[model samples]
Target: MDTQQDWDIYDVTIVGGGPAGMYAAFYSGMRAMRTKIIEAKRELGGFMRTYPEKIVWDVGGVGPVRCERLIEILEKQARTFDPAIVFGQAVAGMNRREDGVFELTSTTGERHYTRTVILCAGRGMTQVQKLDIHGANRYELANLHYTITDLSRFAGKRVLISGGGDSAVDWANELEKLAKEVIVVHRRSEFTAHERPVAQMRTFAKVLTPYRISGLYGSADRIARVALTHTETGEPEEVEADEVIVSHGYDRDFGNLVNWGLEREDYGVSVDAKMRTNLPGIFGAGDFITYGSKVRLIAGAFNDAVLAVNSAKMFLEPSATDMAGVSSHNERFFEKNKAVIEEEKQRQQN
Candidate 1:
């Protein structure tokens, strides 16, 4: 870990590397503030990274964008200002300094200081729920996948999806088109996902309800089959599978934020319309923020990020504009990005 004294305090420190945090980093650069983004994961994009193949349609202007593609675009946009980014570091605690700067310590023992902080740490650290059956861990990397980073891995394979949630049903529907066979096993008859996709999945994929995964079996290196037991009758059944997708859902926690002394609800941190939390110089946004009429959508999170960044700017410099003008007409932006813009235009012209 680098010594804290060796580093310069940033004008803004954005937590979490999801879309909201990434956008905040970009806007902070537009505001000409020195910024840094800290993400716990090895990569950016937050939960979207787990669903790389899923298509995102709600974000305006970008129609039907693949999850991986959107994340790449957002990462590029965030890097426009070249903010310092640290990955695989989870913030463990924070403190306010006498000079009004914030000091953050990570679980890795590294420290960072900043003028202000944005808690875009969406749902904090999240881990996918895994199968409890014996020998499950042995096949985790071989054949059992909690998330789909590459959809082609299941191509022409027999896939078994264990869960009744939206992700499970969605993956089943998606894999049905590529996989040789797709089966969905759930512990309950009723699914927890939206009805439309579930109904669509029934049309193609085999649905086995009121059943729980009992065992996993195969060679020492790979999983070839899974045993399922009926939830009501205790009857057992076996299915041959080339891959297993466990989408039971994620176990999420706010990590150190729970002890940060902020006012929070059962869902997430509470904030005002300005995205200001109860603490001064600290704000919250993304799925981890809660406010009246707040919608849990990527679009909503983007709006939240903008509001939080603008408020943070004002908090840093009272005379600064509350809102930035349109990027298209901003001469300073064009000047800063003149070469890149010109190159893009040249490419289009060709």
Candidate 2:
């Protein structure tokens, strides 16, 4: 079948639709390159989707807004130039042809052609860690939660959270006021969370250290109480709970990407100051790649995207401008600015 993907070879293709990938797409357009984004998930936002209800205030100019709202705005900006977006496809292989175009093949056998590739596969297809206790899966739909997507669901209910990491402590502290009671169970005496949050969590939530959820006692797929076992003493106790939250963390894998020979560390793949990876024509950005003084925040990802996109442009044509002009100097950007102004004016008039 003849398709646009078959005939059109993008100048740059971004793998992963996180903040880095989204900004890369927009910046590539400013550099006048045909761009495409390949995301494994059905939607964008990458790891940010895990914390939709969380309020984000650190994305540079963006004010305090829900993570979900920021995702919407980023997606809107990513589509500024109408780049091709391929969803539900993970690129499992990359091969550069003699013609100089890179061929990317997904696990589903779909393929994309591009001149340059930007690796933005943050955490490399992260999978949420789940409860290991027997029959725990049965109560997942009833009350068990791996991540807190909605806060309203726990209104005025007894909530028990497991683990001692930042997420566990943070959630327990937040749930203290809303839930009838907040119980935090950790297997270690010392929590791995920040000292300030841990101190705050101890102020309200019922903290149990060196303990574990040995068993879940529930009826008909609903947890009524949880049996706790002390790791050191083996003493057992039980706590009643209306809801159970596990912050066991995630199991991340780069899948076949690790075999591509990109220099990587425990944190992520290695990239130079210019965001260039070990593989030529293949750059990286976001938390997927690490460098000296690299920041893991959303603002950091945007900065990396700009550098990677500019490097990709220069790689394609050495004579191309070192950087994209500012929005004021970009001639075609005026239409979008005018449209935004008009929309704001309309809102004001209404």
Candidate 3:
């Protein structure tokens, strides 16, 4: 006789653990729904993990805070409902039952049961673009870095950064005072980063526009010099550096979710005003979905999450409210609110 727990069927399963997915999990719990989150990566934050040090001031009511700190806060909020979180599973297969339940299979063969699916897998399974030069991988363990894990690591050391996007410029600016020298190499003279940041980076870093890294020169395992060639004239130049950073970009792989017959455009999946995909019980938020008036920002992703979660709730119960009640008056927060009040009172008394 086998004594085993029955398969758990969630009211909604969110794909991806980024801001949108995290917020959806919280909102769904507020609506009294059983929820789960399946994340491809071992951790959360999604694309934001790439720039953990960047200051994020755009989030409403959030004074300029580091992105990594915001991620920690968001993760805590997502776990408020104690939803099951599955990590390091890339969703590859989706099977729907006649009774309307969905069985999602990961590439590793794990299965999850859910009544509704919300794809917040922004830049699903992103692969960082590395330096394409031959033998570049040799220095990766030494002085070559694809992403900035610690800005202080380059303190007092010369740093060479390649790319023209916001991340590249941001890195250059951040390392300006920390590093002995900051060099920015880009294939195009016109930077794609925001105008102000680009201008700010130009004031300090050694800007090599319309040029690209051609080769890396070093001994043993660490890169000591970088060969750069002009994009138009092919003029070559070499610069000595103790560290090399590549911020080219990332390649996105949505796995097999794109094959589920969801209407999609070149940018992302198509969704209605209520964040509902054409398929019933399926929704999208964050960078995974596109509509006529999509706002590509963190705050925008939060708005999408609310709409998507509410849509899923209404799908499960047709008579449900279009949105959750304000948190200030929400009964679910009554105890939590009291706890906070008590803590504050104790602090004041002390």
Task: Show how many residue pairs clash in every candidate, following the order shown.
Answer: 0, 0, 0
- lDDT, candidate 2, equals 0.91
lDDT of each: 0.89, 0.91, 0.91
Q: Each candidate's TM vs. the true structure? A: 0.94, 0.95, 0.93
**How do the residues 1-350 of candidate 1 rate in per-residue lDDT, one tens digit apiece?**
33456257898999999988999998888788889999999999997877888889999889899989999999999998899999999988898978787889999998899999999998778987887776688887689888888899899999999999999999998887899999999999999999999999999898999999999889996888889999999999999999988999888966777798999887789999999999999998899899997878888888998899999999999999998877887665777677878899999999
For candidate 2, write residues 282-305 as lDDT tens digits: 999999999998999999999999
Instruction: Give the per-residue Cα lDDT of candidate 1 at 260.
Output: 88
Predicted structure 3, TM vs. truth: 0.93
What residue pairs are clashing in model 3? none
- Give stretches of model 1 more than 4 Å off: 1-7
Models sorted by TM-score, best on top: 2, 1, 3
Worst lDDT 10-window in candidate 1:
1-10
The full ranking of all candidates by lDDT, starting with the best, is: 3, 2, 1
Candidate 3 ranges with C-alpha deviation above 4 Å: 1-7, 346-350
**Candidate 3 structure quality by residue, lDDT tens digits, 1-350:** 12223448899999999999999999998998999999999998888898887889999988999899999999999998889999999888988888788889999998888899999988789999988888899898989998877778999999999999988998998888899999999999899999999999989999998999999998989999999999999999999999999999998898899999999998799999999999999999999999999998888899999999999999999998988899888898998888889999999999
